[model samples]
Target: MTEHLYQPILDHFKNARILCVGDIMLDRFVYGSVDRVSPEAPVPVFHIKRDLLALGGAGNVVRNLASLGANVFFSSVIGQDESGRMLESLIGAEKTVRSRFLVDEHRHTTTKTRFIAQGQQMMRADQEQTHALTSVQESDLFSALKNEVESVDVVILSDYGKGVLTPNLIQDIIKHASELKKPVIIDPKGRHYEIYNGCTLLTPNHKELAQATGYPTTSDEEVSKAASILLERVSVQHLLVTRGAQGMALFSRDEGPVFIPSKALDVFDVSGAGDTVISVFAAALACNANLEVAAHLSNIAAGIVVAKVGTAVVKVSEIMDAIHRDMGEDTKETHLLTWDQARDKVMLWHQKGLKVGFTNGCFDVLHPGHLKLLNEAKSQCDRLVVAVNTDRSVSALKGPARPIHSEQDRSVMLSAFDCVDIVVAFDQDTPFELIQHLRPDVLVKGSDYTVDTVVGAKEVMGWGGSVYLVDLKQGYSTTSIVAKISSGSRN
Candidate 1:
């Protein structure tokens, strides 16, 4: 399989504009060292060192979108207080975003203060009022939203339930978005799931899905049933249930449910992961990606964010690197790129001296064998692009139970490696179309098969390009690992 395929998608992120409307909060982190207990109370005394604050809630969604090169317009509520002033300063400094905040004296700007010691969060303090917005405040917020709703390609309802997303406000936004026929994506709160009627898409985590349906079962069938209920109940055109390690499942009106596995490998803190999801989703929609493709791109973005601690955002370079590494394409010839990011990168590389090399695989579980193959391919090219098979593709080729690691996990792990350059992931049985477009100088595959049998070998060779079969290290297969685990469990 060709690798390093996610470049095009990452390139697409540049210059996109997305409108975010909902509750915004500030995440304040107090970092310090704790060596002794407090004399006044039963608490560890923290010697404060540094303090940092980042956008949280809906603000985070906009921030993530901006990081990926999208021009973001944020519409939310804040108070005329210190924290609110800080929020404005923080967001104003973001050159990619324009803010139209409604100042409400009745409610303070929501802020969550987290105290961290030795890289561990000790406690969190939340300051906010979650009551419904007053009529006057709602009117002001509506007025601000009215000015931008018609101009943006997509609208995101990021409801943190912080008194900003009233039922009335949500209804009006939904109605307006419908008139413009723009996609309205929702990162729903459990309590207000029913109020997001006619949304283009609803992204709910596993816990929220369970809470919304009041179904406690963790079985796939049960979760699917619950997701269906919520989708129909809210009149949403599509529903995405985000399962932490399990990935995500997409349900559309005609396509039904398509499960996209989580890409996270080692999950540290999933704090603002949902915010990352909607931001990427809205950006993808603005770029004219299909619902399934948008969800897949969001799944890749989520994997990138969870690998970091605290509320984080993943950049387009990171996303591209992940896709390339996941696909096992040579990154040496290519710069880091995702499918959304590839068009521009490809054009630039054409002007430069670099030649793109492409390859792909499931890399279900990376072992020394896969590493040897990828390194060898990288050695033969200027840059390597890897295209990974999605969980769906793995099931079609390997088996339903194959790919022990989810797509997101596999992508993150591969992108972190130095040998890889860019990564892209595909759900098709083969990345033939992507390979054809890339028109790499070399098409690489494992030594197990002759070049004639390779999926994209003919396409590359026909273009006067060469097909190289890189040697795979012996005795390292996903099947072998599974068997070893099963044997140990039985013993």
Candidate 2:
């Protein structure tokens, strides 16, 4: 998707007022390092280094909404215990969220403590009660909802199968939210989908969707069939099934199912990824985004959270950056361009009044010196294009054994850096032809080369362009690194 399509939708999130109701809990993480096994048992003993506390379940949804710059009205139940007080304090600390937590004196607050070592979860311990709320508690919750539901742009029911989301309470919430014409988004749980009747959208993972529909959700066809069954039973208008690695599938009444592939590059932890998906989806809907746009934004948000370490919240800036990166990926061809494509791109930049800087190198083995040169080059202009020598050109310049990494790999690595805006591969030994065609505003080279020694200096200077020579870092060279490794191997 283009930035024009989603940037405004993201901007509208700041004005959205979300009503989040359902289970809330404290998520405590103990981070440590495991050195060796304990003598008392076979388990490894961890040396605790630090610990952190974060909102989990529905609270995580509120955290996510708030992080994305939304105004959230969070309603949930908690015990009159220490854990409950902590949870309350945590919610109160968030400036964008207003919380109304009912205190249940008869129960203990839900808390999940996870032990983490070396960036991996070792064990988890939970303390809580699962009994359904009493009639009086339900009445109080409904009363709170009535007060908050009228002003909210959307309602999100984050049910973790805890007592806060009883069948009766779910029905009441959906009915009341519907009366106010607010779209209700449910992060659903359990097999009983009827309780969530009339919800605008239901977000269930692969396992939950399969179990709820009594069918195997192994393929797109199968998932659509299962979702169709749930749509018949429940009054939900749309079903979004989150298939872990495969991404999400959206089934609606008016249109056929639309699948959005996962954008996650690295899956570290997926603890509260669902909360992120629902939070972004609801917020986008609240901002008047179409169903497909909302689903796409949610997919991006989910990708961000899963790459994090734990039950995490994504900020608006992170989402914006991800969108821009995705946009860049969509136009990957521009980054790795031919001479004609590079000329076209340079002309486009020139039309926009952007200064284009040109640099050339084999970039066989990227080191700190190369990064410093590129960074300095970028500082001299608005856009920096690095001309990478092809494998054959590098072999001619630096011998056959040089360029341990291929030209494609080098080009990709340079393109990944934010400082280098574009990468173009040149077959010639030097970038003389490439530079002449682009006619960049500035020509950059290392300090080792004087202006007269630079290959394209005369051509660039003839067009009122300047030449900049960046200082290189000492004691860092690709040639030296390769030689050092080779010597070590011989030794």
Candidate 3:
């Protein structure tokens, strides 16, 4: 593919309009620090610290797509209740959201409150009504949906079995989307798999797939069979069966099921992971990504969401960063090339008195901390050259399953950054040779590392260059992101 081919795809995502229909829920997180045992009981007592409320379910899917720069329009049935008002307020405030909603007085809006203490989920309370919508409500929904379907690139049915997605409603949406030539993606729920027939794609977890198909997923073969059956039965173009740790399986009519491994390193809370997958897939498809590419990208997007807390959305930046990190971690070295080979172009760049900043790491999992460090490295110099350890090198330093994104992908992504002037793949135990050849004016590392301990600190200092420590962005690190996501808190 040409360098700019994917750029247009990403740009398309920035311009695509997506309509999200079905259930909308409010996700409320009650966060506290557990410091001591309770006086009344032996159990730990949590001291309340803060609380956060975010869009959940189908609403979260739109949030994720919106965060990734899509033109999002949300439509759903919400009760004429306080939580419904809250949902309206939140969705209305977003510039991209064009909502088509109905407020039913007979129902209460869905809201899930997760209480967390000491970075762990303590309990959860759910409030809402889940019943099939009346014919009148369904018709009203279809009327609004038909009007919006004509103008969008794709339609996402985010069903939490929360009443809005009746059989009639699903049928109408599928027919409308088909007529408009818009892809319809269903993030389905309950036992209503047949209701999602004629969808462009249906995304369900392994359990859901097994339940819907009456097949046990003991191995990849079984998973493939189930996915194929669902795809054929539902008359959908694609079937994505998400297997938690084993990753996802994609089954299409033209192509057999392809198993994609989970990209997530440390899974925290898997809340809304399916939403992340469907949103990414729909957005990628709307932007003209091939089904396989969309599936892979959405898999990576799920990896990002699972690595965070709460019902979180994955940004396009996060997806690109994941792709970059995967590339860096998968790089393989042919052999140790001589300085003549490795330093040919690099030597010229160094000789120009450019304040060449060098920062080297496995970057196995790129996070906000890494971004902050790279940005700081660039700020201290005219050009930033990021030296990433090769796959073998990372394995040696950080052990197995180290670098997530392969080295080539990482290099390509990092090179795309404005702050990153150049990217050099290194295979040695250290980037000593690259550093010695580049002789950077500033050697940058995270503040957690002292100047003396930085790998290339001494070399830079010996050549009259400065070894600087850039403090990590507070509360933003890969480890923290992982922990928070696992803990089911987004704060």
Best by lDDT, which number? Answer: 2
| Candidate 3 lDDT trough over 10 residues, lowest sum | 333-342
Indicate whether candidate 1 or candidate 2 has the larger lDDT: 2
All candidates' lDDT scores?
Answer: 0.79, 0.87, 0.78
Candidate 3 positional error at 289, Å: 1.5
Per-residue lDDT tens digits for candidate 2, residues 1-491, read: 79889989899899999999989999987755679999999989987644567888899999899989999999999998999999999999999999899999987889998887654678999999978999889999999878789998999999998899888888888888888888999988889988888889999999999999899998988998999898988888998889989899999998999998999998867889999999999999999998899999999989988876567678776678788888775433334776755765665455344778999988888899999999999999998889998989888998989789987788789999999988899998778988887789799999999999999898777766899999889988888888989888542
Off by over 4 Å in 2: 36-43, 329-491
Q: How many backbone clashes does candidate 3 have?
A: 19
Off by over 4 Å in 1: 1-9, 333-491
Model 1: ten consecutive residues of lowest lDDT: 1-10
TM-score (all chains, Cα) for each model: 0.67, 0.67, 0.65
Identify the superior model by TM-score, candidate 2 or candidate 3. 2
Candidate 3 per-residue lDDT, tens place, 306-375, comes to: 8665566676756765676776654333323333333433433432324568887876667777888898
By descending TM-score, how would the candidates be arranged? 2, 1, 3
Which of candidates 1 and 3 is the stronger one according to lDDT?
1
